[model samples]
Target: MSEILRKGDIGQAVADLQADLRRAGYAVERTAIYDNGTRDAVAALQGATGLVVDGAYGPKSRAALANFDVSRLMRESDLIAAADRLGVPLASIKAVNEVESRGRGFLADGRPVILYERHVFWKQLVAHGVDPAAYAERTAILSRQRGGYAGGAAEYVRLASAMQIHAAAAQEAASWGAFQVMGYHWKALGFADIESFVATQYRSEGDQLATFTAFVLADTTLHRALKARKWAQFARLYNGPAYAENLYDTKLARAYARFAGEESEAVA
Candidate 1:
């Protein structure tokens, strides 16, 4: 390898590589430099692929780069537009969506099922003091909890159901949408009256994504998940990133391509 590499080539490659690593739950930097972080990412990739653990960027590394797709990184254009309407940051929306359905349609098996077992949804309801029953004996409690306690459940479940998880709250059905909301917790977060809020704020579906993004970005759980770079752990925190990766295989690649631009980054 040459002492100096093409920054453009390196950046583009690194971005693509890093996107692949990210999809696999590896933490990688988006910079184009061949820094220590990049080396560690290379080593981890090599180990995962059963290749030589040399950190040097060479032919093997180049070939291996093909395995890492940079096209899956999050893009903020849509989220940014949504945030502008919602008065939030684009990063916040993108983060939550990344955590959720990875910006794809939700629902288990592409059907109208609830996606989680009744018991699971029940448990989540218990946490927020909101009941999913057809009728609520006490609408007052439901109302109080519905704002930031019970909203977004229907939509979340709808998305997860499309993904094909039988039980409403099973591990497989844990996550939903681009925000990967778990059960009724999303409603508890103040999105319960999304229709009213959207109307009041004059927003759209993009606002919903951005609002959720801000919620996740502000959450300690999400922050820790990003810092640890533990996709599996984080997935469980929301839903399963592994399952999500499988679900959004092609879409995620497109997302990376759309967001990463021409940068070359490696996935860990």
Candidate 2:
């Protein structure tokens, strides 16, 4: 018997809905939160299949999903290309992938994993003639804090509030995808624009990996550090001054060693 899936649901079933939606080319994020994005995707899928567009994944929707072939979500060739382009070892790239993403990219609500910069959004609002003094406390709270969001759905809820002030600027204020690259870096990372960057982020992990490659390639110092296997330097430059607090450099080194050992074993 197929389980019913609806908005507000969480866990493995929600994750499955996201995965099958992606398989159906619905452009939903694989995050386990059944937020607006998931609801919209479900609606889109239902409309296409001539089912009742209620946005609920019931028995009928499950049957449809079962018929569609699951698409390749990531490619080894893309990873290899990114590594080669950055002039870094595959193990090094793998280390970053493992350390940075831990193998998850999108939230179940079909949005890329993001940490919206509320302080940045507030600044943008103020610049756009909105009064920050009115939302002063909220702005301060958003600025000082990070990572309380349960999933992409929660992040989007916060983002929607910011969007009430300035949509484009709010979008620009968030870090997106498995790489957690800032949207403000879109131009620097070779994306035609922020929207294009966001779209790519919504597409798949492959696009995120490509963007990460572009980001690494754009920063000569970071690229050099990566090629040299300077984990501390790389982590400091990539992750900011707080890298030591998280022991990001140490984790990178350990991950690199593990990946390199696996590679060596594969060759042997």
Candidate 3:
């Protein structure tokens, strides 16, 4: 029965826990900050180990971690399958995976990685006939919380709070999984509904990759960009006009080059 390591509970122990998670093949920053990445890695670990996927490193999670084998998390075959299914190069898929989530999908609290759009949630609630005044104050609070490059844990907290107000709309208002695909795109991406889409997100990274593949395939423009190795076009379509702000195109190009180089070396 080890002590718990949860979001916002930062210390050297948390840093050590992150190190253990990373060694177990979870993509977590070793910053000791117990941020969103830490939460996601913990959730992935819990899911993989059949532990409670609460993203909290409690006694059971710690016990499971103690004996966890990192090799069990490998998904190279799945990536290849997804790339083949989409008729895109594996390097393109790998590049998107690297730029989008760096290959992690869940948060420490067992939820898929999300960026809760408070404004979007507000609009959804309004569309659903919910009184905006009921959530106005809290939405205002969440609106003021800024996200950094990788996003912040506060988005999760805000999402949790918003879910309490309107679960269905809240879920639809946020983006999910490694690809950060918006929940609203569930139908266009071939999901039966938002709930089904969210369920897939929680299943595994392979499922997330499947979702990404479906998304790319559904958008002919994005698929063409990927096939053509047009990183800028892919970034513009996938990330919007703000893509330049993050240098997403450059990142995609670099990631593609790295994966392509690896493939070339393997063939050689």
The C-alpha lDDT values of all candidates are 0.43, 0.75, 0.74
lDDT of 2 at 68: 42
lDDT (Cα, tens digit) per residue for candidate 1, span 1-268: 4432322346666666556656766677767565666667766665555443435444444545566422222233455565464443333334334435433322223321123333444354554464446433333222223222233346443333422322323332233333444434445556554233333122323434554555555577755653444444555555445656554434333433433432234331
Q: Estimate each model's TM-score.
A: 0.34, 0.67, 0.68
Candidate 3 to native Cα RMSD, angstroms:
9.8
* lDDT: worst 10-residue window of model 1: 140-149
Q: What's the ranking of the predictions by lDDT, best on top?
A: 2, 3, 1
At residue 245, what lDDT does model 1 achieve?
Answer: 58
Best candidate (score: lDDT): 2
| RMSD vs true structure, all candidates | 15.1, 11.7, 9.8
lDDT of 2 by residue, 199-229 (tens): 9999877788898889888999998999999
What's the TM for model 2?
0.67
In model 3, the clashing pairs are: 39-107, 39-108, 40-106, 40-107, 40-108, 55-108
- Single out the weakest 10-residue window by summed lDDT for candidate 2: 68-77
Sort by TM-score, top down from the best: 3, 2, 1
The local lDDT score (0 to 100) that residue 176 gets in candidate 1 is 35
Runs of candidate 1 with Cα error greater than 4 angstroms are: 1-76, 80-117, 124-183, 186-188, 192-203, 227-233, 241-268
